[model samples]
Target chain A: MTKSKLSQQLAVDNLKIGSHVYSSRLIVGTGKYPSEDIASKAINSSGAELVTLAIKRFSQQDAISNILEVIGEKKLLPNTAGTLNAKEALRSAQLSRELFKTNLIKLEIITSSENLDPNMPETIKAAEMMVKDNFEVYVYCDRDLNNCLKLEDLGCVAIMPLGSSIGSGRGFDDLDDLILLRNKIEQILIVDAGIGVPSEAARVMELGYDAVLVNSAIAYANEPILMASAFKNGVKSGRKTFLAGRMSRSKSSIASSPTQFLK
Target chain B: MSRIKIQLNGTVEQIESANLEIILNTFAPKDRPFAVEINGEIVPSAKFSDYSIQENDKIEIISAVGGG
Candidate 1:
């Protein structure tokens, strides 16, 4: 039997987000895992084409070797975590580029520790510098439509708007803002951080977000593999629903039985 | 012979070595980057040349990986 036209269209149109091409627009993080093995399994199950990692001190006693080995040829995205200024972010991005051997950098500049709120000014500045330095910048910013547009103007390949505070597990609080940002920004719109459950991810994708990046939720789950699978399904379902398009909502329900047809 | 034990890829192993760099050179060549953990603390890559290993010392090495 021939497939539906919607499915055929979706199959033909490839979703392009920045430099990365994804059949499934879900990005996962590699942190807070019970074990490296579980993290690897979870990531593979999630079907994420891109992943995030922080550049920090690598210890002699560290157990990340097996994890690295497991990752093999997958894309490694190094983030500039805890950088409060543009200079620090730039330096971190540069170092990560050398260390991870990838041009993709998740530009994160924090202003306060309470909420891990990103400093928009610094983030924009750092993004500009990284772009000029020939790096693909994914700026993690608050759910501010204006700021998102500004970041897009700064030449960021992707604008990662937070669903909530980083690692808060609160999920998407500003759905309106995210929707507006999605409508305004031409670049890739990714919801990064604060996604507590698969529903949150589904909600973002349903709202037409290009992708979602999650870390703590999967990493800290009781069963990382199960949670990862959940996320993977949620993202796929959401993207499918969005592309399928929904019927227009009306306050009054349309009766299935037509009054004019009644004898 | 003094037996120096360190965690290799998260597994404990013992070797006989007097110099730290020699042992590391024997295991991980300088060309590659690996995070070395001694006991529970991580030894910075920059200090690998200077850091010495003693008998029964636990070491762990982790490398940057790509996934997800």
Candidate 2:
């Protein structure tokens, strides 16, 4: 291969989730926006090819404008966010498949209401059920390498590890674990949740993660549209930096000029 | 005309008939995409006209909502 061609491939390119290829590596969500107008605008500014959504009972009062109507041409990734057990998660997945007409399902089962941490056992069960049902599962879990590996073995299309508790905005709690997971797994790694700013998103991408899913960060920002744009640039910059390779850390200062100066 | 009572999104509602299509026309927004489930079984939109709802059948009409 030509040097330029090979170098171009090294730079972060399109993202592949399951069989579908997307141009953007950042995935935004459609929740917590002041209005549907802002949400659509933010998503558009983010340049996200895929967006996350939830399945809820239809309510005419709240249905003045449908969420599907605003989000045009982007792939929908329906998540089982409210489910507490494997059974509920499975039901949500099934219903999402029918509603969105897509096999992509973000499996998130949280047991505790306060922490909103993933119920690993329940997530596993739901992943198994989703796999059996022929859905492309993206399992969300803590930054535990073992758990992520297990999900990969279950045929999950993606492994989404939380940077911290969902929506806490605490940022990455353990950088070591994240780097370790990146080194250990071959499946698509997406750092989901707790990304408060563009820098956090960039850091995750710099660690060689395939993608970063930002929701509350952009939605709650003072300017959702602007924050969305910032995140888009952040993800791209970090990916390019990663491909360029960073300089090694040094304990002692090294002189860039001649050691001896003319007296 | 006979009426049937069914649970709609966890609330009991009285409808004129047991037909799924009529019930949807009354409750669902025609412009949006939605999925119907009766007693935990998904009824495809194409089958709505032919499907009959049983008494006390738990029905849920759902659509996409904002979430992350």
- Model 1 chain A worst lDDT run, 10 consecutive residues: A57-66
TM-score for each model: 0.78, 0.96
Q: What would the TM-score be for candidate 2 when compared with the true structure?
A: 0.96
| lDDT for each candidate structure | 0.77, 0.90
Q: Which portions of model 1 miss their true places by more than 4 Å?
A: A1-5, A63-66, A257-263, B1-68
The residue-by-residue lDDT of candidate 2 on A77-180, one tens digit each, is 99998899999999999899888899999999997776688999889888988999999998889888888999999999999999988888899899899999
Candidate with maximal DockQ: 2
A185-250 in candidate 1: lDDT tens per residue?
888889998899999999888888888998888888888899999999998888877887777999
Query: Model 1: how far is A162 from its true place, Å?
Result: 0.4
DockQ comparisons of all candidates to the true complex: 0.11, 0.89
Q: What is the TM-score of chain B alone in each candidate?
A: 0.66, 0.94
Best by lDDT: 2
Candidate 2 global lDDT? 0.90
